[model samples]
Target chain A: MKKLINSAESLTADALAGMAAAHPDLRIDPRTHVISRADAPVPGKVGVVSGGGAGHEPLHGGYVGRGMLDAAVVGEVFTSPTPDRILAALRAADSGRGVLQIVKNYTGDTLNFAMAAELAEDLGIAVRTVVVDDDAATGTPDGTPGRSAGRRGTGATVFVERVCGALAEQGADLTAVADAGARVNAATRSIAIALTACTVPAVGRAGFELPDDRIEFGVGIHGEPGLRTEPLRPASEIVQDALAVLLDQLPPGDDDRTIVMVNGLGATPLLELYVVLNEASAVLRKAGLTVAHTLVGNYVTALDMAGVSLTVCRADERTLGLWNTPVNTPALRWGC
Target chain B: MKKLINSAESLTADALAGMAAAHPDLRIDPRTHVISRADAPVPGKVGVVSGGGAGHEPLHGGYVGRGMLDAAVVGEVFTSPTPDRILAALRAADSGRGVLQIVKNYTGDTLNFAMAAELAEDLGIAVRTVVVDDDAATGTPDGTPGRSAGRRGTGATVFVERVCGALAEQGADLTAVADAGARVNAATRSIAIALTACTVPAVGRAGFELPDDRIEFGVGIHGEPGLRTEPLRPASEIVQDALAVLLDQLPPGDDDRTIVMVNGLGATPLLELYVVLNEASAVLRKAGLTVAHTLVGNYVTALDMAGVSLTVCRADERTLGLWNTPVNTPALRWGC
Candidate 1:
């Protein structure tokens, strides 16, 4: 696959070791693959933890630091973390105040995180779970929208992590943090487009094939087939088409405020992301929403997939205040 | 090339417009392609300005904001900016304090910036220039390291902008900022490798072809030929080999403190970059150098090439302090 890796078997482990070496503030357990802040389990503050597959850079792991996630349990590339591993992260992250689990709405991820939460409760540690399913793409494999596996969580998980983590850092109780996450997830919508598929290290080939003149709209992070394959259009039109799905779902409100994220799936350059964001901002303004903040970069990436994803979240004064709060993480950092 | 661009003719302009739209704090002139901070020409503070070929995201443009470059003049993809455009940037960025020009060690960039500096001085604004030439790649076309256009500046350009930018933000005069940048350029060294060639949109083809089983070692940013080409090796071994070249150039000392940056050349995933940094730290320590800080990610990029570059800079107390100063640019930010 011509990737800069040692081997497919040790990809996640080697990466975690490298991350820990780079950031001294982060502590890692090599066996459990749980990366936590050195000062995790803050006595008075509620602990925040999240986990999923490891291919998405800066998702759960890079967000582990002050004013964000306390612990991040990592799984194999595009594979779910085990119940025991999630349980280990829960145990490591919780102090006296309890822990909150932010999970994506994948079948394996939800199942494993739920099992871990149940096991943590058996040990007298309070745990709460928030499942994020904010992808706005149409036509799942099953005809029903809410009946099948449901929309795969894509970009809203980033919102859930930031909002919930900030609230918890302010010493909010477990319920408040979990509720904040739920609200963010409910208000958020995301859609992605991919020009090329990503190759998993083990598989050693692209997940799917795409013609040069066509693109996949509403593609997922793992290179899953999108809602449909269509002829490639200009970047401006692609952004408008993606946000059309979001605008349809958003309720009309006067003086509405919004937070936008133009996230690169993997191999897309940061320059193109700014273009996507500029186009998204224009369409959002046309719909009477002010983009309060715009983040354009390659955060929450798939493994070398060439694409960009748009995340639009309805924000209030409180959400804006929390997002502006000082965050000191590897990927997202500002105002500190 | 399947790039997310409107057209080859308007890629840079479109990206610049998008960046300006995303960041209201920065002001841009479409005709001149000059981007400056809204608060540029801060009466008493020294101005920092940089420009080069476009294609390197977050280099000259993204570095324009508070505590960094006051202005960035952009050029066409892989082409140098015209002297007139650069003169415009110099004029806009200058306050009472003279402007310091940071130019990469490329033939076109150096010649154009020199002309611009002369024009700015003629218009009654003082100007100083620092040219970076830290690439450690072997086999220049002329076969002489000291002559024949010298080494093409690669990753160390980020260090030059940062350390010098921080000093300028702290009110360092033009000469002081230029000297700091020169010292950084002298102490820094960088080497890059490429697994695949990046395609320029206008060209509509890859810059060069490399077999799947081999890689170009010590390659320059524009798919320039490197010291040699060899069979693909594991990430760990490749890192060791790259460092061996640096170790030769680096003077040995007791308790030496160094700053390490593992830069991804655009298309490499962040997951693989951490692995490179981890191996680099191990090798640096084995050589008795104390690694003070390690920055890992795609700071300096080469379009869509799949590769990684390593930059190591010897640092003293002052250099470390300057590096810690808060930088609120679009790409790098910390320590407010």
Candidate 2:
């Protein structure tokens, strides 16, 4: 394993320290790696918090800011944040309205964030939890949707958290915010493709291996190898393969009420994201799926892995409106 | 050359189609690849616009939302968004309050966005432009601050767009918003390192070669190689090397007014980011440069290349306030 670092075990701590030094907008409790903006615990605003392992860049920590999350708890690479750290973030983010935790559908993350919420509740802070099982490819073997994606939260989690964060920041009740988040999660599904594997710093080397010119379809975000491997095909066909599964899972609707997310698996470039979006739109149009909105970029990524993930969320007027709400974080901002 | 897509030529189009088919909250003008929210041109708000190549994911496009950019224009991989495409986004984003064009330092992006701004002006729409040139290390080989980084905007551009977008959405005049963005660019400086090479789809292989257990310091975002090669070092030492150059160039300050951005070069994970941040902060603190804000993530990537970058911005009260303001995008969001 060839990497540049002082020590593998110390990588996470060292990295967090540098992050604190570099970004002034984020207040880093390096002791816990819980990242909040400089002026956290906004007066009277319900705080929204999310977090998980460290490999996924800008997901948990990068999303800490105004229109989105109030704080983010970061763990080591591919490791879930500890309950203590999460509790710290909750303590910081908790405001008069309440606090909501957006937990991804991962075993570790769910357990830790849920426990932290319980702890917060014990402290008399109103706390709510929403688990995002947005991966359509979860619960299945490696080939079919929900078979082999490995309990993935995929893309809509980012959207869900932002929408929920916006609602909470607007002083919505915890239940209302949690309900909105759950609804959004239920309306979303995702699938991914991988051309290459990522090298975890500690583990040094590609996480997995694929034959040249082969593609692993429906992979998880943490460098878990995908479900099926096949010879490489045109970008259009790849989109079709992923969309065929997604379309079948989505509610049949011509209602122009859906959001599209084309996420790069770590290393895929934006040009490829555009292709994915273009092909995805064409597939949806052919399948009578109406795309009401679109996002193309690296939302959830496997460290340096080369590929893309497609996430589709069925949006109602309310969800769409919430999607337009403002949020402040390191990774995303716009609607508020 | 180990990518999974069948062909490089159709990568962008196919990906866009896939995204459109999957998500409902996002829309793509299939013809133009401009990504917008489901309900664009929101009432009573100025439209914020930004665009560039497709390589940088979740940037201009992912950032298009209510509190951030109103619309994002995407070009081919590592290529500039065409004038026509940018003009389409400008038209889509126009809400009568005027539009702000937040462009990176690249010549291509600057030229294209500038042209689009001109075209919008010709059409009687108010337009403002801010060029981001935050890279410090690659700035001229002759030691000039703005010559060697190939006109790359790097991560600070994200800050420019977000704050400018916020002010624009808040009904700040084009000039005020542009001035704010320009100030951010002026205060910010960035430097990067690369551990390996990235494969551009068109190139179908690593953009450059690096020996095992080696890292190239001062690499450009587009994989333009690096200024120097060194044996791979630990996170602390790596951060030291990068911070050494970056801090040397920054104006001295012991004041509590600095924004630090520790960015992951494509393949580096968040754990490593924190480690890098640790060393960077120590260096900055020793230099009497107090960190008031910070962001650590894959803000500006170089495909799947493994490495990291550092960006430091001296902040004043207004800049700090602006940084804390709300932003809503697919990537970064925060205080609204």
Candidate 3:
């Protein structure tokens, strides 16, 4: 692989070193793999922490700043952070008011985060958890959402962290912050497709491959096999199908308004992403839905996958108000 | 080439549609390919307008919004916008206050922008221009700074747009705003490298190829060959070389404080970009220069090239203040 890294083993540590050097606002603890705001553990304010594998950048670590996650505990590429690693982030983020853990719905991630939350509680840090399972193609092969392996939380993970972090930064209690996260999770739905598979740093080759004329629909963020493979088509057609799957599962809210994110799966160009975004917004409008907010870029990503993920979250004035709150993370920033 | 596009001919138009759909705050005119703020022509406010070929996204178009470009005119990928298209944007942006055209120093662009400026002047709108030529590799093969063909404007174009755009938004007169852009172009220097060649949609193939163990140093944004080819190395080493070239040519400022941008050329993952950012910061510190501001991502880009570019501009309190001012745009947002 022609990747720009020191070595596979040093990828995470090296990247964290870079993060620490670039963002003095973040406190990067290499020993624990915990990246927290420099002034984290704010007195009397609820703390927010989120993390998972390291490949999907700016997700966990880049989001650790004002108005976003207080701390982001990252593991190696596509590997879940250990329980101890998660525990350290909890310790870093928690103040007297307690902390909330926003975990994705991967099997290892959920299990590890749960264990860490329990450990923090025993240490007198009251910790609450919200697991996001927004990926619509996680449960079964025929496009039915199930809970056996749980829906792999995809793009909406960014939304949960931002909204919940904003609520916490606004001085909401831990329970309330976690509740907000859960509500977002309930209302969000995501669908992903891949033109090419991502290659982990440790492995020098892509996880999978497809003929030039084919694509994997409903792919997971880890480059795992998706619901199925299909012939490649125009971007508009691809986005239309992805949006249909997402709309079918997106929870109903008080209004027919939504926040849309046309996320790039690492290697797709913004040119293509915008093309996808254009089609997605068109789909939403045709379905009688009003798009209240839109984000177009690589927020959460696979290592080097060429694909796009569409995340839609039902929105009301309250949720949008939370989204519009000032945020100063490395990845998502606005309002302030 | 495997790409998520309808066809090569429709690429730019489709992407613009998506851009317009995603950003309702910006009024997108399909006919002129002119994207201006819906509330543009803030009476008596200095109008900031920019345009260029379309492949490098978020460059000219995504930068259109509050405290940035008042309007952006786009042409087909890797092709300069015509005089009339630029004229349309100028008319859309001007409202009593004269318009400033911040352009890249490409032959076609310079010629067209000049023509458009004259056309706008005849139409009763005073027009001023600043042509950015910050790419360090464009001069001589030995890396000497010269004006022959001019240095291909690259990453620092973003810096110029942001700082100058902010100055205009702050009500600076047309000449002052254009001067600010010129000053930034003078102080800024950029160097880029590629691991692979970019594939234009019409071409449907990579412009060039590199062996698994080799790379192109000092590559241009448009997939042009750079200073030379070299064996692939670690991220830190590559960044160190790129920074050395940049520092060699970066103008001496009042102080050693500088603003650094580790820009991804479209397809490079943020993970790798941060690693480059980390190395660049270390190089700056080692050189006894202070990094006052840092921007890391695909702010400027090639369509789907796998590469990175490092840009550094000297920063004083005044420029830092302009940088820190609250600006809202699709690509870069901060300091509200």
For each candidate, the alpha-carbon lDDT, in order, equals 0.87, 0.75, 0.88
Expressed as tens digits, the lDDT of each residue in A33-56 for candidate 3 is 999988988888898999998999
Which DockQ-derived CAPRI band holds candidate 2?
Answer: acceptable
Error of 3 at B138 (Å): 1.6
Worst 10 residues of 3 chain A by lDDT: A139-148
Writing each residue's lDDT as its tens digit, candidate 3 over B108-208 gives 99999999999999999999998888888776544465656878888888888898889988888988898888888888889899988989999888999
Q: Model 3 off-target regions past 4 Å?
A: A140-147, B140-148
Query: What is the C-alpha lDDT profile of model 2 across B1-336, one tens digit per residue?
Result: 655454767666665555555444577787998988666776666677888886666566667765677788888778998998999998888777777788887878888888888898899878888778767765653447555334467878877876777677667776788788888787777888888877788988888888887788888888875668888876677777777777666555435568887776666656566677777778778877777777776666665677777888888877777777766455666543
Which is better, 1 or 2, measured by DockQ? 1
Q: Candidate 2, which segments miss by more than 4 Å at Cα?
A: A2-6, A18-28, A32-49, A64-72, A82-101, A109-129, A140-152, A166-177, A251-256, B2-6, B10-189, B247-261, B291-300, B312-336
Which residue pairs in model 3 clash with each other? A336-B336
Listed for each candidate, the true contacts retained, as a fraction, are 0.64, 0.64, 0.74
Tell me the tens digit of each residue's lDDT in model 2 across A1-336.
655567867766666666655566689886888889777798888888988887777587778877788888888888999898899999999876788888887888988888888888888888888878766556443324444324567687788887887787677877898898988887788888888877787787788888887888877788665557888887778889888876666655426667888877776655566666777777777876677777666678777678888888878888888778766554565543
Model 2: DockQ vs. true structure = 0.37
Better of 2 and 3 by DockQ: 3
Rank by TM-score, highest first.
Answer: 1, 3, 2
Candidates 1 and 3: which is better by lDDT? 3
TM value for model 1: 0.97
